[model samples]
Target: MITLSAFADEISPLPEEQIDVLARHGIKHIEFRSIHGKNVLDLTDDEHAQFRDLLRQNGFGLSAIGSPVGKIKITEPFEPHLDRYAIALKLAEFYSTPRIRIFSFYMPEGDDPAIHRNEVIRRMTALAGVAEAKGIRLFLENEKGIYGDTAERSHDLVTAVGSPALEHAFDPANYLEVGQDIDSAWNLLRPQVGHFHVKDYCTKTHKNVPAGQGEGQIPRLIADAVAHGYKGFCTLEPHLVVAEKFYGFTGPERFGDAATALKTELNARDVSFA
Candidate 1:
């Protein structure tokens, strides 16, 4: 069955309210972005315990920890980031989640893509080693302005890492952000995709749009993944709603409008957790 999970950030930083909204929407799974008023990697043990308990009581599964683990400079040494990854792995174990979402660090201008790419693979492999020991999967998400922005680059990174613990958390909208063809991107990364991110974007205006209303071929992307035997959570990452706050520096009212629009689009697609 295709289970739908919402990205907690879509509902903002309020856990209690987020949980209530998710339950109202019939969503039983969630990919958490932050915890205890801190990034996932910065959560303390007590925070982790409380978070785990809250989700358990609500009958919600922690699908993955949206860790900002590797979304730094690719030139920087891996040791500092490894420490963050350690914490994230521990948190995942605490929550009993089998996976964590990661991002490829941004490479600076004039930097050699080849050199940074190799470094990314090396660092990811090391992180994968930690995940292997903990029996967890490290899912790399493609993001604009990052080294692994395109599916081809993501595939190369994973292939170079050469660890089964590493997999792709495919986000089609991110590809659209960088002007890559979404369908081709899906074809490139489908084999290594362990999870899915349901999002959409508009390239002409460089704006994030609600699912199914933008250039992202969401239905076709899902169909392609299903054709490839992907039976995993089609995680709803309503980034278009949150992008204003995080990117455009918009207000809460904007978030409310975007969320309502998102819910409407999801309904039109006949996509629901219930």
Candidate 2:
């Protein structure tokens, strides 16, 4: 089955409220991003223990750790970021999830992403090494304005890393945002894609919209992924209420609407989700 998971913090900053919203929506897996207004990477040890225990008690399985492990600028120092990743790995272990969503670092302003390609690959290899050491998989998301924004570059990064710990997460809307076609994206990265992010790109506004209501062509992608026996999470990254660079918020109603919209596409294809 194609399972559905969500970055629950989009519903609320409070962990309790996040869980409540997921329960109401029948979402059993969480793409743990934040809780109580703190990023998953910044959670205190005590906080981690308490929050993880709560999830265990509630029977919420984790689909991935939505860590910003590689979301920094290409020019930023690497040592600190790698240290931060240690914490992310700890969280993944705590949640018992093998996958962690990540990014290839953003390029310097006004510089062609290609200029930093070699550096991006070097850093990505290092990041993949961390996941490989910990027996975890890194799901590299193709975000706009990053080194791996295009499917082609994303494919290159994962290929260069050459580790099962390194993989891809296809966000059709993200590809559209960067003027990359979904067909080519799916063709090139299909072998590497571990999952999808449920959001659509708006051609007119150049913003994100609910799946299937915009330029993402989400339904087609879902059908193709399923046809190829891609069993993975369709993680909801709905930026419905507000969109920003670092993070976004959908609130309860908008978040629920986003989930419903993606579910519509899944159901249209006669696919089942957990």
Candidate 3:
């Protein structure tokens, strides 16, 4: 069965607000990107423990740690970034979660991606290796402007690494924003997808929209995923209000709207989700 989760941080920087809105929508898990305006990776040990307690008390579980582990520029020094990645791994263990969402490193603006293909693979391979050693799965998201933003390159990077610990966290809105045909991207990358990010984007308006109200083809993707026996988290990441490079915010009401839009599409397809 498909399960529901979300970037609750989109609802509010306050943990209580995030949890409240999610609970109201029947979402019991969160993607755990940030809380209190700080990214998950930057949370202090005490902060992590406190949040863990709060989640447990509220009967919430973590679907994944929405980490920015691989969002840095490709040209940045790798050693320090690798050190930061270790923090993400620790967060996963802290939350008792096996999954973490990540990105392919961004290519320099105006540069040909082909020239950096080897480096991207090399970095991804390294990241995958660390996760594999810890028995954690890294879900690589196709963020706009990243090396694997397109299906073909995403496929290439994943295949080149060839690590079972690495898989796709398919984001239809992201692909749409990058000008990829959703159906075609899905056809190519579906087999590797281990998670889904439920959101939609309008290429024409260059804005984020509630699911099924934009060109991301949310309904078709959901129907297709169900038909293919896909069973995993459909994590809502609606950037309906403020879409930014490192994060986005939808506030409480808009987050609820996005949640309803996704549920509407799922109900139309008779898909079962928690």
Which lDDT tens digits does candidate 1 get at residues 154-196?
Answer: 9999988888889999887788877898878877778899988
Q: Is candidate 2 or candidate 3 better by lDDT?
A: 3
Residue 28, model 2: Cα distance from true site in angstroms: 0.8
Deviating ranges (above 4 Å) for candidate 2: none
Instruction: State the lDDT of candidate 3 residue by residue for 165-224, as single tens digits.
Output: 999999988898888998899999999999899989988899999999999888788778
| lDDT of the structure predicted as candidate 1 | 0.75
Model 3 residue 251 CA deviation (Å) reads 0.7
By lDDT: ranked, best first: 3, 2, 1
Please report, in order, the local distance difference test score of every candidate based on alpha carbons.
0.75, 0.86, 0.91
Instruction: Give the Å shift of residue 260 in candidate 3.
Output: 0.8
Identify the superior model by lDDT, candidate 1 or candidate 2: 2
Q: Which stretches of candidate 3 lie over 4 Å from their true place?
A: none
| Structural similarity to truth (TM-score) of each candidate | 0.88, 0.96, 0.98
Compose the digit string of candidate 2's lDDT tens values, residues 1-274. Answer: 7888888888999988888888888888888899998999888889988988889888888899999988999999888888888888887887788788999998888998888988888988888887898899999999888999898889988998899999898888788878998898889988898878887878898777888889888888888888899899988887877778888888988888888888878888898778
Q: Please report how far candidate 3 places residue 173 from its true position, in Å.
A: 1.2
* Pairs clashing within candidate 2: none
Lowest summed-lDDT stretch of 10 residues in model 2? Answer: 238-247
